[model samples]
Target: MTVTIESVITCPSCSHQAAEIMPTDACAYFYECTSCHLLLKPLAGDCCVFCSYGSAKCPPSQEQKGCCA
Candidate 1:
């Protein structure tokens, strides 16, 4: 099955708006916010930045198997 997720995330430190593409096969550990040039990584124990703060979960995590595993 094909999985997808979309969300608007703001950097916690810089409040930068970041539009991210959640990968179906892997978790994104780091995201660079274009607006504020902030480098974001998943919070401890989270799979991706989306999971840490975005309104939506990453595509891999949305699957029944869970994120990147």
Candidate 2:
């Protein structure tokens, strides 16, 4: 499967959305929402903020390779 690098992260607090370029080599452990400026972290069992709040999973997750492996 082709790994996707783009993800849309929606802030839970304000419901604001932003498109982000996912890092291929590392997990993005934290993200700050552009609109609300709320800090976001990965949910339990997820590798990155993208996996937690994004419309698409992070690149590693999409590729089926364990994130940070």
Candidate 3:
């Protein structure tokens, strides 16, 4: 199955719009805020981009596999 998800992040420091894609096979650990140049990481207990921003949770999380598993 082709698993693709999109999410948007607003930099807390600069209010920059970051449109990103969540990978199905891997979890992204860090994201650089384009506008503020701040490095973004998953919030406490969050697994991936979808869990943080997307309308739906990450695929693994949805399956109860947890993040990056």
Q: What C-alpha lDDT values do all the predictions have?
A: 0.77, 0.91, 0.68
- Residue 69 of model 2, lDDT score: 70
Clash count (model 1, backbone only): 0
| TM-score between candidate 2 and the true structure | 0.94
lDDT of 2 by residue, 1-69 (tens): 777788999999999998999999998999999888999999999989999999999887887888987
Across 1-69, the per-residue lDDT of candidate 3 in tens digits comes to: 544466666665677776776676788776788777787776778976457645566667766777775
TM-score winner between candidates 1 and 2: 2
Worst lDDT 10-window in candidate 2: 60-69
For candidate 1, lDDT tens digit of each residue in 1-69? 665567788888777676766666777778887877778899888888888978778876777677866
Error of 2 at 8 (Å): 0.4
Error of 2 at 63 (Å): 1.2
Better of 1 and 3 by TM-score: 1
Candidate 2 segments whose C-alpha is farther than 4 A from its true place: none
Candidates ranked, most accurate by TM-score first: 2, 1, 3
Most lDDT-accurate candidate: 2
Candidate 1 at residue 22, lDDT?
64
Give the Å shift of residue 22 in candidate 2: 0.4
Ten contiguous residues minimizing lDDT sum, candidate 1: 16-25
